[model samples]
Target: MTASESMATDRPDDLPLPPGPNSYPVVGNTLGFLRDPFAFYDSLDDYGDVVSYSVAGEEFCTLLHPDYVEQVLVTEESKFGKSDFVQDAGERFVGNGLFASEGEFWRRQRTLIQPAFYRERIESYTEPMVEFAADAANSWIDGETVRIDEVMKRLTLRILSKALFDLDIRNQQSAIRDAVNAINEKGDAGSVDAFLPDWVPTATNRQFRRATDQFDDVIGTLIEKRRGDPPGDDFLSILLHATDERGEGMSDKTLRDEMATFLFAGHETTALALTYCWYLLATNPGVRGKLNDELDSVLDGDTPTMADLRDLKYTDKVVTEALRLYPPAYVVFRQTKEDVNVGGYRIPAGTSLTFPQFLIHTDDRWYDDPDEFRPERWTPEFENSLPDYAYFPFGGGPRHCIGMRFANAEIRIVLATIARRIEFDRVAGGDLDLRMGTTLEPTDPIEMTVVKR
Candidate 1:
């Protein structure tokens, strides 16, 4: 008999799944999962690397080890697909865009849009990133308290607009921002929506529908306007003209869906990342001092350009380390396509897979003094020594985030520009706690005072 068959036969059918928390009849672990999903996942670390649980009759398994994560994300990606719950929730906001689409459609869209983020294309946006960041910094009252989270959100939105669309929608910024926030706020907090039907037209549902329409109208108008205008180097222009191997261009709806996906996905994660970065810098003066020293030597207090990015090594390490601790997208969801064995555990088809980046990133096995903020630990030698899946702030495998390079460039440039021109001090007391939503963000306002240099 084959070893695979032998192992499978030896494992009892009713041996009970990997150890997990006991659940109330029928509802399963729904209450525990909803109370605090991140904390619940963290608690599973003590259970074992592979822990199983069921919610409302649905089965799930959380993979903690990097090797197991790699099996699901990279080596065995074909055996799985994006979770249906996540895809359904995402489609409510992003439509059938790349964020929600699967199979051949996703592959084709990814191919057509890939060129917009090429090295040359991304490098072209550096000047605007620095300019917008400087404009934001200059607008702040030096001695007064500024809501750094809002500041980063507005700055990133502007940068994504200028960098990707090459147009200004400042007049519509507030409305668009509100619409996005409403959709995110109403999403089944922490856990995916299983109990509530979106069609019920509750106040939040009506608001979500109205907000989605407003966002769609704005994006649709921009698409029409670009059709008649002279060809430009913006991302919109690239998407408009792109042709697949069969020379077929995307339809208007497809264009709108992808644009919305980029606008939504592009800004929020980066904004939260920058927000957390500032919080870290404020609390850790030594790391901030080293960062400022690098900036001073690199640019001599001038605006940074694409050429300066290579010289900003420590700046890169700081951003990398921040992402390690507080990845904006804390959890990734996938569902099995067929029965599979992950690390000797048999999982049936349609089982939900949760890969917690927040947990894997802080595993003491990979990082020494994991809780401590140490940028210097991310040296070339140390980074090379780690496994690929061990540090995936942007995710792994073929379906990883397409704009990783673009986001990194924007974060480094913006962080350097601001850090060079201003210093920040922590104003809020007590340990800063995280609030889970569409992305992981601080529960309380991260109030900080900016000291202009």
Candidate 2:
């Protein structure tokens, strides 16, 4: 049925399921989705805003319209819960941390964790953000090729480790990086390995287990060391001392989970954002020129401080545009907790729903030349004219990413700081072949030659 026709019906019982592609007998749409998720999701827009499909007998829906996205993420969020895939996969690595937990426990954890990302607390991280960006920029020899993705991941991880844990984890970065890679590979949404039970002995599972073990060893030692010492001012210290209305704090296990979540989600998303921003800049010289002009005029070769952010308008726009094109958290998944009507169709309880930011951000209805890298399109007037969920990279509602403010500030600062000293020239033939992972990742390394500006 058409969306309008479905919506005209008042009774949930009278609504029909959203239209979707025909599924195979047993595998459903699994092979098609796994073959190329981006293409698969893009094809759904042809069906309708709300489209239904299945994978291995599990029913799923994709909400393409921004209003439907708002209903699921904001207005009627409580009626939905974190999808089992997210909870099950995430818990294996991050434990019952904010990203995986549900119900009252999730609320309490959010309340306790909220203080770490307060404006004042985030502002304190600016020094480290700029310092790390500067360090990474200086270390790159002019005309030398670097893998932009790896560079960003390391730089962001160092910044986050210092800001969140109050430790310089340069020595431990290799192990942490390996663990994150292994976890992401195993947790990838379209991977067959993702659906397999953890108890099953497989090569991927073995690597995943070893990686998690190494991760636990590193984080466990840090937590234990911090517990015996006097409290300090980093995120770890804040979480350690933070008490609820009941005057209780998190246990060691909870602390480990929170640490793991912050370390992975906090750093990885920002890194990918920056990586894509650099890639976009290298390819679109006009935007890169405008960005360089802003950095030059604002900071004038000096490292950017938190105070310099307001004047870095174009730099911010470049970051915004990059995020629009390559949102690291490409899609968000949620499961229905009760029967609900969305866009005139009934979504039954326990159905998996996907809201693809990548799809919505590039829809022709919301953007002109949606695939083009045009930072100029992000004027304040233009921004105000769009639907709210159309541009949400960090998500929305009560469960919006706690690290949003922190990430925005960091992206602008790092982009400004590094751009002031260096420029990247894209290596010929280095195009990003996108892959859907725990976050959006390039199938091949993103290589670029560094040049002193």
TM-score of each: 0.94, 0.97
Spell out the clash pairs found in candidate 1.
none
Cα lDDT computed for each candidate against the true fold:
0.83, 0.87
The predictions' CA RMSDs to the true structure, in order, are 2.9, 1.6
Off by over 4 Å in 1: 1-16, 191-195
lDDT of candidate model 2 versus the reference? 0.87
Tens-digit lDDT string for candidate 2 (7-72): 443666677877999899899999998887778887998888989999756789999888888878
Q: Compared with the true structure, what per-residue lDDT tens digits does model 1 show for residues 1-453?
A: 322232343343334456777778888887888888767777897877778898656788888888878878887799999987677667767888987888999999999999999999998888889889998888877787998888898889988888768976555586568666766666645644434556776777788778888888887898998887776778889999999999999898999888888888898899999998999999999999999999999999788888999999999999999999999988888999987776566777888898888888999989999988899999889988987788988888988999899999999999999999899888867898886777887877888898987
Query: Which consecutive 10 residues in model 2 have the weakest lDDT in total?
Result: 1-10
